[model samples]
Structure formats: structure tokens, C-alpha cells
Target: MSYDKEVGLRMNWPMIVYISLVHIVACYSIYNTITRPHYMLTYVWTIILWFISGFGITAGAHRLWSHRSYKARYPLRVLLMIFNSIANQGSVIHWVRDHRLHHLYSDTDKDPHDSQRGFFYSHVGWLLVRKPKRVLDAGRKISLNDLYKDNILLIQHRLCPWWNMLWCFIFPAIVGYYLWDESILNGILLPGVFRYCFVLHATWCVNSVVHQWGPKPYDNKSHTTENGIVAFIALGEGWHNYHHTFDWDYVTAEMGAIKQYNPTKVFIDIMYYLGLAYNLRRAYPKGWEHLKSRNIRKLGGEYHVVEGIYGIPPFCHRTVTYVQGEGGGGGRLLSETQVDNMSTTDEEGL
Candidate 1:
């Protein structure tokens, strides 16, 4: 078969329907939970799994693994890996490779889920098309030697499907067997299938709603935008503009001042402080300054252009640049001397 012919066949609707039925089943389970109120335990399990899946996608799959924003220790990586599998998303290898391609060729044909392809494509239509060559070619471009060498990520990748089945289905069914003994709806539907579907759609929103609508606090041309509501639903992942611009910055704690986008940031901080992760990165003060809005809505002071050693104005309000590196200020606002000191610290840290 010709390559073009193969590409045409790749976007098969029947294939898509077959593959996505699992998700449909899961969604139906969530729907049925309303009727089966006796099994409240399943509801709690569903919410907990839903939350864990967000952490797996945002912190584990997207941030740590895909973007290489920070270094995680073995224990945390392993725990996140298990959650990731339970989320029933694609394996880390596929997730990272596809994501790297998205970054490198955002909003273009090369992007796996370019919004320009249309909303449905961005949401899940891209998955309907088999792009084995594209996936492989893209994977080759983004070398994940670090992850390959990491024993934890490797093991997780290997056992992902099985782990997904066990935790998301088998384990839940086991609990139901012990309790209900006869209700498939109680065990499998409420907790297992339903919870998985709820989590899947929530995570998929990052790919869909985030790209389609939101404030462009940073770079809008890239298709990623910042939305506070999306962030609330996506566990802080809706701060897409900040993420795309400063992909390596560990703290997506706040997008400007208005939206409190920090669930993922808090999760990262906990992992870092506990030594489960390291090398937490922050947006440069100047770069961050550019993204901040200059308005009354901005609670922080408006940015000022202070001439510095190079005569270039510092970008942020916190910056107090001076010719001779001499000035005075206190608190979050920096004095010239403090700016110089901080610049030196930044250089040394690098």
C-alpha cells in the first residue's frame, strides 16, 4: 500500500469508534452512579482517582517527563507512574514524544493535535488517525535518554497497561466483590469504569478547551492560552500560555495576578521539598515581568524600566536597575544593589 493511501486509511472512523468505546463505557458508569446511591464508597474512589489522574498528567506525564522541567527522585517518579497508568492515558513514551512534537511544531501540521486542524481534532480526533511514521519520526527527534536510563520510568512504561487494568478495574471489582458480591454496577461501573472516564475527559480538556479559549497572558500565537476556569478543572494546567513560553519553569504558580493557577505548582513544590524532586525552575524575573499585565487589575505594582549596567531597563517592577548598581528599596521591590546581587546569584545558579 502507498504511504498516502495508508495515511488516508489512518483516519478511520470505525477504528476510532472501536478504540474510544472504552472511554464511553467509563462515562456511562459515571452516569449510572446517580442511580446507585448505596455504594457511596465507589463515589469517593472515583473522585480520588480523578484527582490522582490530574497529578499524573500535569506533574508526572507533562511536566516532569515530557518537558523535563525538573528532576524527580525514584520514589516519587514510581508513585506518579502508577497513578499515570491508572489514569489509562497513553504510555509515557508515547505521551512525551507526541507532546514534544506538539511543542516543536505547535499549531502546524507537524503538531499532533494542532488546533488549526479544528476543535474535534484537537480534542481527540487526532488519535483516530494512525501516524506511526510521524510518531516514530518525532520520537527519534526527541531523544529521551534520561528517561530511558531512569529505571523507574522504564518499569512504569513496561507495566503501564497491566497496571492500568489492575488499579482501575480489577482492584475496584475486588472491593465490590467483598462488599456487594452481586452488583457489577456497584463495583465496576461506579468506581472502575466511571471514574476512569471522568478523569480522562477532564485531562482531555487541557488539549481542547485550553487551546480554544482563554486569555493570552503570554504567547497566544502558539495556540496555548491561560484560562482560570480551565485551570480549576485541570488542576492548574489551564495556564497554558505561561507553560508554552517558559516550558522549563517549574512554578506555574500564578499566571499574572488575577487567576490563581497553582495546583500543579503546589504538587511540584511538595515533591521538591520532600526531595522527591529537584532542580525546580522559575521563569526569569524579566521574562515573567513581560507577561504581567500593566493595569489597575494587576495588584502588583506596574513594571518600571530602570537603566542598568548595560543601560537596558529591567523588565519587572521588582527590578531596580542602576548604572553604578546603587539604590534603595525594600520587600518584594528590589534595590539596585539587591538587583545586582540577585543577578549575580542567578548567574551563579546557572
Candidate 2:
């Protein structure tokens, strides 16, 4: 069934035993490292997990499955699915259900991860506690037409939670035994414990900080807002405000086109461009231009005026006014070509 009432199972004992053993091994390894002090190796392992889990969450579960930003080839999808499972947030089906509900109800009492409940509540409390009745009601009503049909995603949904125990914890313990120079702590602590914990909070910040604090570019009433600080840590997801305003557009800064480091979009675009993926939906040039204007205004710039824009409807306004510097000054009205070129220049600078 696509939708059903969420049921509670007394926490799975087998899963608990498996996770605890992994933790014990990892802690032992960390203790070993305290005596050996292989800080460099620990750092290296941390970087590896950071990149893998970061991509797994962003390119795999998020843009790929949750947003359907682009399509991936089977091989890449399989690899990404494995890493996402290791990230151990939850099954894609569950994550998407909660995420789709967030978009539908947004900041209302129905939002599964609403920031109105406080930062910690939004970040992790919702996951730890029984879901609210309103959220369960919304989940039962949510449509899964897009997700239910994809065989690959369905496979991911089925295997991700199990992998959470094996790949996320057990594999790290095994890897520590083999390559961590007789130091299980280095392997388990750096890549296993730390990686899992870090990725969890990074993903959760989108529902928490991105909404509670940041600049609102498009629709101010939307509780979601853009947070650059959060994005840097969360792998370019900080542009939450832009994302909510135009969820259909693949990239955060309008159709996967960002002037700076949007590694998430970059990875997806590469896969799509290289024939490993396809059907990437981007905002029209005019839509992107409007976003730029709104961004400038939101970032304290003033007087964004664009004239004779072709694709934009005649009645559609194409300008923004905001404070720039100590004294506000006006810049030239930018055309689609101008905006593209300017963005290119900014990217080059980056």
C-alpha cells in the first residue's frame, strides 16, 4: 500500500545488538588511538566519510529520490544508494514521506519537522519521539505516485534501513580491523560514529535552522529561508528559501545554476550531462533572472530593474530594491544574457 497508518514496533532487538557491538568495537579503536595518536590517519578517514556520506545524502537520497531533480544510471544509482544507506537517516520512502509532507503543510502544525517546535525538536526530537497525530494524518494522505513506480527507488526504500545497521556500523568495524593500522577507534570513530552523527545533523539543519533563521528571498511568508552558513555544512542545501519557492527547479539558485560552490548541483549536472543521468528540469532563463533580482534585494542590494524581458509575462514584475553599502546605489538592469554572464564570471572567480 502506498499510504498506511504508521505503526510502532518495540525497538528491534536484533538491530540494537548489532549497532551496540559496532559501537563497542569503534570505542575500543578510539581508545587505541589515544595511545598511538594517529591524528593524520583519523583526519583522512574523516574526509573520506565526509565526501561519501555528503554525496550519498545530497546526490542520492535528496536530489535523486526526494526531489527527482535528475535521473541516474543504474550503476551510479546503486553506488549512491549504498552510501545513503550508510548515512542511516532512514529509508528513502520514509524520508520522502516526511519531506513531501514538509513541503505540503510547510510550517503548519502538520509539518513533520516544523521549527515551531523549537530547534532541537525540529533537528532530532521529531525522529526520537512518536510522530504527531497531525503528521500521521498527513502521511496517510500523501500521494506516492512518482516514487511507488520506480523499481530502483523501491529497492532503495526496502534495503536502506537494513544497510543502516550493516554498512553504517558493522562495515566500519570490519574496515577498522583491516586497514586502520590495528586501531579500530580510528576507523569506527572517524568514519562510522562521527560520519553518521555529522550527516544526520547536517540533513536535519535544513528543517530547523534553514527555516527559523535566514534571509527569505521569494515568498517571505513561507517559513523556509536561505541560510548560507547551514548550506556550507549541509553540502549546498542552505539555499532552502530559494528551494521551497521553486521546488521544481533543480538547483537552489534557480535550476542547478549557482555562482559558487553548489557541489550537490555540480555532481548531479555532471551525471546528467555525461549520459549517466537525464531529464534535469531547470528554471527558464527568465525565472532564474527573477530569482537573481530577488536575491540581490534580499542580500541588501537595491533597485533591480530589468526591461523588455522576453519570456517573462508582460504584467510580471522584474526588479528588486534593497539597501546596498552604507548608501544605497542602483546598478544597471540586467538582461538574461547579462545575468548568465555575470553568474559565469562569479563562478570563474570562485
lDDT agreement with native, every candidate: 0.66, 0.66
Measured by lDDT, the strongest candidate is 2
Give per-residue lDDT, candidate 2, residue 39: 46
Task: Estimate, for each residue in 26-144, the C-alpha lDDT of model 1 and write its tens digit.
Answer: 66765666655646565566677667877888888888888878888878988888778777776877788888888887776667777776888788787787664654576578877
**Backbone atom clashes (below 3 Å) for every candidate:** 0, 9
Question: RMSD of candidate 1 to the true fold?
Answer: 9.7
Whole-model alpha-carbon lDDT for candidate 2: 0.66
Every model's Cα RMSD, please? 9.7, 10.3
Per-residue accuracy of model 2 over 232-285 as CA lDDT, tens digit each: 777788777667867766665532334334677777777777888888867657
